[model samples]
Target: MTHTLVQDEAAIRALFTSLVEGMRERSPARVVARYADDAVTFTLAPPLLNAGLDARDPEAVAGWMAGFDGPITIEHRDLSVAVSGDLAFVHGLRRLAAVPVGYPEGFSMWTRITVGLARRDGQWLITHEHQSVPFYMDGSFLAATDLEP
Candidate 1:
């Protein structure tokens, strides 16, 4: 029983690592595979001003890959993960970078992200993820007012 549990943990870690790599590659197909067919994503952007939830069908998820103009990069830190039965969650700090339109150079942002995973049919997969940027008065990343949408 202990051996089986250890194996499960390793498998889950591998899957999560793959998912991160895929995100860095800006390959939506790889990212979508980590989620269930009916998985939904909520994005918090200032322009959107509200939490926008999108039901990710295969086509929708695949199309999302087209939105990136250039490669995406993610650096993870202080990663903590735990699994309970068929559910698992990972939390950590991330440095995210991407090239936006009209910008010759890319920009990087730091944030904290929490990912929720569920095991289905003995395979671990991500079900949900939420990212938040902490606002500090010390002028670290972004100010609290900057986060206002």
Candidate 2:
């Protein structure tokens, strides 16, 4: 496919790249910095709905990062970024790879991701983000975490 991102789309892509960098670094401040003050997020964790940056709370994010043994790497796949005016959204898959503090064996999981962004004051900020994994349709409705892209 002949894909050439426009200026806005390029900027948004860069923003996502930086966000991933922050996540790998496990820096709460940097991780949350790309989001707007009232950005809503539905993470892989509990709570059906997160009203604002609650999902990206500095303390909560830091605690979660602490659960990992070392750096947390995120790889985005099948990414689709669309931009129109000041509103934009990205649909993609994110693979999180990390080793837990107590578990010597590392883990890697791919989750569906959707990120909504809006341009404010000539800057692009994440206004919403949702991440989830599919669930088995069998008798046991457990999350399908072992799937690969």
Candidate 3:
């Protein structure tokens, strides 16, 4: 059991690495490959939640990724993973640094993330992903994008 847990953790870690590489390489297909066929996401984007099918669409995904002026860089920090049987969950802070096509100044923000994964065919795949940036309690209610981990 100990050995299996270690292996599982390593595999999960590799998935995050793949995600970073995919984003950096501007390959939507590569990034979506980490997810299951039925994956769902509550992304930083609008509409509250995004369908897995939408994410799987290479053209659409690529279009959004292309908004970046160049390669997109992301770093995962203070990540925590827990595994039990074929289910796992991870929570962490992700820093997304990018230069949008129209924004020469570029930008970077830290978002809280929670991901749920399931083992299918002996491979772990992300089934659900949620991301958010805390909002101020004050009347402004603006997202605290300026904060860091």
Candidate 4:
């Protein structure tokens, strides 16, 4: 049982690592491999909205990734992951690069991201994600905006 748990954890970690790499490489196909067939993704970009997709559907995943010109770079830290049965959750900080010229400043904003994941068919996959920016004003972390719920 202990060995099985360890292996499970290792597998989940690998799945997440691969997803991160895929995002950096702008490979939606690779990223989609880490999601379940009916997984949903919610993005908080201005004009906040929710979008749903099927992970097993490669065409849909590829189409969504096509919206971006290239992969977005990310640096993750303080990552914590836990798995129970077929469910897992990961919370961490991510520094993302801004979109190129003519995009809004928000597009260039670097922010922190939190994500939820699940395991199916003995494989780990991302099921949901939430991202936020740490508001800073005059070099100090603005408690009100930065810590707003």
Best by TM-score: 3
lDDT of 1 at 135: 74
How well does candidate 1 score on lDDT at residue 77?
75
Task: Please state every model's RMSD to the true fold in angstroms.
Answer: 5.1, 3.6, 1.6, 5.4
Candidate 1: count the clashes: 0
Error of 1 at 14 (Å): 1.7
Instruction: Report lDDT (CA) for all predictions.
Output: 0.65, 0.87, 0.89, 0.63
lDDT of candidate 2 over 47-116, digit per residue (tens): 7777665855888889888888987998898889988888898999999999999997989999999999
Question: TM-scores of the models, in the given order?
Answer: 0.71, 0.92, 0.95, 0.65
- How good is model 3 by TM-score? 0.95
Identify the leading candidate in terms of lDDT. Answer: 3
What is the Å distance of residue 96 in model 2 from its true position? Answer: 0.5
lDDT per residue as tens, model 4, 28-147 = 778777766555555444335344554345675465556555556656667787777777777777665535434544343445667777766656777777777655566876623323
Quality of model 3 by C-alpha lDDT:
0.89
Residue 79 displacement (Å), model 4? 0.6
Clashing pairs in 2: none
Q: Which of 1 and 4 is ahead in TM-score?
A: 1
| Model 4: worst 10 consecutive residues (lDDT sum) | 140-149
